[model samples]
Target: MSEQITKVNSWVLGLTGGIGCGKTAVSNMFEELGITIVDADIIAREVVLPNSKGLKAITAHFGEDILLPDGALNRAELRAKIFTNNNDKEWLNALLHPLIRIKILNDLNNATSPYVVLVAPLLFENNLDKYCDHTLLIDVPTSVQIARTVKRDNTSSEQVKSIIASQMSRADKQQKADDILNNDRSLNLVHIELVDLHKKYLQYALHNKTNSH
Candidate 1:
């Protein structure tokens, strides 16, 4: 951890949480607090844009059916395919993860903030934790996750369960987090946690970016 803290510039923070875990809300609060954010979801999309290397690799593997009538990659189709076929998902991850990492590294290297926030759902899953000096997880109860996803997505209980099943367990996340912002109650409390975390992380100011294997 100390090694990681030494490698980072004063420009990157990794903020992560699973589905319906309020990571976006936390990141938005940080934005208001004047930190720039580099979102992995956005980077994911950028990597797959038409004719990019990622799209080319994807098309070569999955063929043109993965592309839309407008020529963009059919993300929904690919997502479903990957979810059902672990091999395909692994293959896809192999194709894109390195590219995304390179992009993120560049972005982090260039960020002009006291520190930037990286909101990634796969921060832990993809071994990107090494890129961050400190990792903050927005911890929410499984019950909260199920209730929130079902209500917000208008999905069934089983469907929400399946989504949660796809992510790393909450216990695993909590164990790995440097700071856990609890968000099982009021929105105001969640915001308060984010504010408190923002101050703490900013003051914590340990700029290490070691790429631990």
Candidate 2:
């Protein structure tokens, strides 16, 4: 979402995947490598906190129906509404994308790790890849995506399908990524690949640091 970092001293890898594609697990593996991770999902929640301006704007546009009894955003209801209506989805994105971008850039600029991982499900959709030195996709087949998502979210098959349909397709994402990691196998195997990528990223970070002088 952000095209230029106000201050970014470290290389950033934008990691993304479709829903139910094991993004969290992959992000955790990157974290275990001691790479700092700036998570879009966590920041998305933060921007919409009870009294935040982001929540205020959302309520103004979508109305109080989008809020729960405790004044928090009714994520489920909002998700349903947006997915069903293109106009609602566009409006919500217009409101939140800028807020999310600012927060993400701030986090990136402040990162102390050799390289930072910007983990976002909508990395490509939101054009967040523009901020990163490289885009890494966690790849999986659509069938696997549906199976894992339905199991993890306990949502209906049709709903999972709808969410999957809403996102950028696997093929398009793979084509756009600078690199990709197949995630359909066991966690141990995934970790082996991640460790290898960790080494590669460290080398990239070091090379960039040397060139910046």
Candidate 3:
């Protein structure tokens, strides 16, 4: 595939974490500091909205059963089907990943913040890390992940474990990260770390902007 990122206008920060690792909270902190966040999960859904080309093509390939009565993609059904079948999952990724990447790039470019965060759960999985100037990983333990996810999603511990097992492992993500935010502590501590990172990112963006002139 071609580069998902085009000409850079500002620094791009890739923020990611394994399931139930408080990624949303981390991103929210960045947002509070006036950093724009282009969320992959949001764009992934937007690209396949009712009557969208993505949705149309998906319906043609997966049939109407993959859509809800209101013409929305049946996300739960699609997820279940794809999870059980590797071919189906690959087919789905082939269809959606490129589209999602394009939207992410566009959104990143359009961001007005000093620096922007490309927030994605699968940032590493989809190789979106390439688009980033730096990667930030939110870290937590597997046991904490299971507990938090079950509490948040009301899902079974087994199901949460399965979800965690599917993503890029914590150790690998930690090694790949340019920065790390340990989310195992209180929210106040997380906020302090975010403030520090926000300052660092601003400086990075300013440095880039100055060099570009």
Candidate 4:
């Protein structure tokens, strides 16, 4: 097939959250409902993998220490350094954001589903809102965020707190969301919410299709 002739029918759904808000877990639930999920983190990592252009740009900016002995980007080191320095964060974003966006579009354009979920932690912060048809925000308390992230990431509370500080406030995220999921409940409850939302989203898509037709 020609590169431009791929048959992906994906409808991008932007997923966002504050740190440790279980956005990924929620997105996984959406995937269970048969939506194609195009994750930003995975695409970001893929673009920077060994011989990619993003990797070359990163190496040029941050030097060889950001690379493993085998030349892959040392994610931990780069993340720690970037978070502590605003300039580095901006520079890194400048170096990588465009490439990541292109890769995401390519994946979206190739997915074989009626819709795609774009899971991005800083979805609004990066102005990626333009790429999505609608946005979903996973809502949770700040304390829950700190606790969950510390346990899941095996990091200090302070570290998770710093990551949270780097993100937009939860209330702000909620305000911009087209869908709101409160994961402050049991897993079964969260799953129930996901199922309900999936039904609603399908109806929404059908509504648009019918109206357009």
The candidate that wins on TM-score is 3
Give the residue spans of candidate 2 off by over 4 A. Answer: 1-7, 62-65, 80-88
Query: Which lDDT tens digits does candidate 3 get at residues 6-76?
Result: 66576999999999999999998888888899999999989899989889988998899999889899999
TM-score of candidate 3 to 2 decimals: 0.94
| Model 4 alpha-carbon miss at residue 184, Å | 0.8
In candidate 3, residue 60 scores what lDDT?
95
Better structure of 1 and 4 per lDDT: 4
Off by over 4 Å in 1: 1-8, 83-87, 206-213
User: Per-residue alpha-carbon lDDT of model 4 for 165-207, expressed as tens digits?
Assistant: 8899888888899999899899799999888878777777676
Q: Which 10-residue window in model 3 sums to the lowest lDDT?
A: 1-10
Candidate 1 on 1-213: residue-level lDDT in tens?
A: 012222456546789988888888888888888888889989989999998999998999998899999999999999999989999999997888778887777777677777788889989998888888789998888888888888998999898888789889989999998888887778888887788777777666542323322
lDDT for model 4, on a 0 to 1 scale?
A: 0.83
Error of 3 at 96 (Å): 0.6
lDDT of 3 at 92: 81
Score each candidate by Cα lDDT. Answer: 0.82, 0.91, 0.90, 0.83
lDDT of 2: 0.91
Which segments of candidate 4 are over 4 A away from where they belong? 1-9, 80-88, 210-213
**Backbone-clash count (model 3):** 0
Candidate 2's residue-wise lDDT over 1-213, tens digit each? 454645566799999999988989999998888889999999999999999999998899889999999999999999999979999899888888888888899999889989999999999998888889988999999999999989988888899899889999889999999899999999999999899999999999899999999
The candidate with the higher TM-score, 1 or 3, is: 3
